[model samples]
Target: MSINPRTIRWGILATGRIAENFATDLALVEGSELVAVGSRRLDAANEFAERFGAARAHGSYEELAADPEVDVIYVATPHSRHLDDVMTCLEGGKHVLCEKPLAMNAADAETMIAEARSRGLFFAEAMWTRTNPNIRRMLQMIRDGVIGTPLQVRAELGYAAEAEKTRMWDPELGASALLDMGIYPLTFAFLLLGEPVSIVAAGVLSDQGIDVNAGATLTYANGAVANIAWNQVAWSDNRGTIAGDAGFVEMTSRFHEPTGFSVTRGDQTETYEEHVIGRGYSHEIIEVADCLREGLTQSALLPQDESLAIMKQLDEILRQLGVTPR
Candidate 1:
């Protein structure tokens, strides 16, 4: 197979599960190559690079960030480390795609965005769910008036986690039901309806002061509302629905992953399904390639401002619950 010269060279800056999933998807996406993998441990980086067929493996993130051959760096570290990792890459003149909740808080996200802008670099949060084809189609349907004026959106995402052990329950890692799983539903709501005018939230906190289960109601000025819920201590339906004056759209299990959804109105319904390649991560990789080729500094699909706004909402949710960072 011949590789295109225009291919975007991806340098993955972590060897965690999400990093592996994304690299596998990048392998399937044309015009993109995983050129490097970095980890705090040399052996881990080498092993991951070998598994992903990356040409270079570095023991330190700084090495990967400083590599001139790497056109872009994907910061797949934890939420607390995102700002530092992304800024390091940006300082090295490498375009960055940081994982979502772009940072631990909205303030940190603002700093990272400002740094990227100052360097004239491409920076985006890897909100892969926003890049799914079905999501794009659904958003278009809403915009086309197929769903009329969106009046309300109800979405939930959750997974069982023990408050004592997992990172989802750990404050040191910036873990909380809201920051980890909750961001999905929140971002989904924000996508359908822009920033809400007011937010009311309630949460159950663990002994460590991190939220284990959380629910929020967002009110928009146009009378639109969203009920978003997330829990780290129990499983949920993990589905979503958007209701408009005309009809509604319903997504099946795993609202964040590849699945089926239907739009219904007046006894009429249309279903759309997609079986994505490699856990749906390829779609985001394609978006990155397209944007970079077009000389875009940020993705129109997942704008930096929208990401920052979502982070701000998450920060507010945590604040409402009085969960401070460790």
Candidate 2:
């Protein structure tokens, strides 16, 4: 927590597809600038920097972290690299917004969060779904009792990825339906209802021991329950529904980055439309900027503890599926 900069200067730590998307969204945010790009190869970094209109390109992540002009970094490395990549930014005296799943497991996520806490740095997982406009509004409505005493949640997010994405089938890389896709539904349930009391999970594991498809029933203390599933072998409807005694809300297809949602009470249904900025990634970027300018260490919108809780759930689900937690 230093003097908050008027215009946050951002750095990208890996020029992957996520990084490209982030950079695109960052441009849409006010009072933010992408000052630098980093990658293992200088050529890749240079290309990304040029394409993104970044002024500096570092061949190594270490070099990018050391750049004094960079107020914060967005780490877009793979899930397996989050622990190390986030630590590098923290060690370099920079704030960070790392990609989702935070880490391979809760333990590693704890280590990263603790380091950020000890260093008094702002850090967060880039769980953009939480920051999407429709999701935020839905959360408010649920809290306002638009849906009274949410009793059950049904959400599924999946797509065919095993054939085209080698990383999705690699255990060493920490690939699993739970980490890559299921986290949305899990987090969705957690947001609407608090943490569950017990979780019963089952899944299909690949020969490599990574989960290819999984489903879980999470029961809460108040008898609330959530049925969520994810898959890498096929396409799901990608919809989510939260039901309560009074009424319910249905998040449209690709619920994670929802197009919109309708709230139903008896025969009356109210629908809300969403015009998300730059594929909905800009919302998180704006949140990060707001937090930085306000001198907050963590976002209330997506707290560090919540991220850890979801990671713990992810670990438990993987373990139940006979895929050893990485």
Candidate 3:
């Protein structure tokens, strides 16, 4: 783990599996320290803190948010509770890096953004893929015209999750393929093409009213289109691609992480290798630390407008698919 003399004190607001992963990644980052963690149960909180070498553990999110030593809080709670948890952290005078799908809807996201703005605090959606090194290179290639005139895109991620009572299948917890797995592919597509003029979507819902699998087609004003899909019903290629008239870029299956990919054009192909540290969450962690140190409130990589736009697309797609967004 890289250590920085100028440290940013961090407080984790949940003790779930994602929290553990994030904590492990944070340990690998420089200029950050996991000072505190919170969970609904004191035992879980203590266990998380002991496992991650955190100095403080709070039984309730309120106590953790109120901790005067924590400069920032990472909200790793369920999607249904994201709005409240983020507000709690912001209200307690701490910056926040909330998990993806920062809120249940665009309206809630707007509220979170406005609250952060009014407080002059740093707030960002933790779309970690946006900070991946290879993703950055791929986007730069597209921006530098490696792919001529982007015309169409395709992204897919799927897995078979059959537990009916778990958070992945329970509508009460805002569970769905779209929010759980689709956001990555959707955000990937949004990075390539801005807001779409129209979106067509279809999906199959489980008995709990959550989407088991869903697909969407986004048509941009520039006539570019993206076909993206996500599911919890079956395993698929889990590949992502960007195709243009001149060339195409392909991310290997499970493109969200630090994985190798390739580019091809005119019978000549080039492959790029990925070398990253610590589950790839460190990039975003370091991004947050850098932003906080520089007094920036948001990241250009994962901007508020982009997050909101993606949320709108998600809401619209779910609406069209007859799924009530919680």
lDDT string for model 3 (1-326, tens) is 12233999999999888998999999999779999999999999999999999999999999999998898899998889999999999999999999998888899999999999999988999999999988998888899999797879999988988785488877878888898899988998888997888889998987767778889998998889999999988997888999998999999778887477789998999999767778888899999998888788999887888899889888888898888767
Instruction: Report the alpha-carbon TM-score of model 3 versus the true structure.
Output: 0.97
Find the candidate with the highest lDDT and give its number: 2
Candidate number achieving the greatest TM-score relative to the actual structure: 2
* lDDT tens digits by residue: candidate 2, 1-326: 45446788999999989899999999998889999999999999999999999999999999999998899999999999999999999999999999998999899999999999999899999999999999999999998899798999999999998466777877777788889999999999999888899999998988888888989999999999999999989989999999999999999999999979999999999999878997899999999999998888999987999999999998888889998757
Candidate 2: segments with Cα more than 4 A from true spot: 1-5
List TM-scores for all candidates, in order: 0.96, 0.98, 0.97
- Model 1 TM-score (2 dp): 0.96
Model 1: residues with Cα > 4 Å off, grouped in runs: 1-5, 162-165
Please identify model 3 stretches exceeding 4 Å from their true place. 1-5
Position 318, candidate 3: lDDT = 82
Writing each residue's lDDT as its tens digit, candidate 1 over 109-150 gives 999999989988999999999998888888888999998999
Question: Which scores better on TM-score, 2 or 3?
Answer: 2
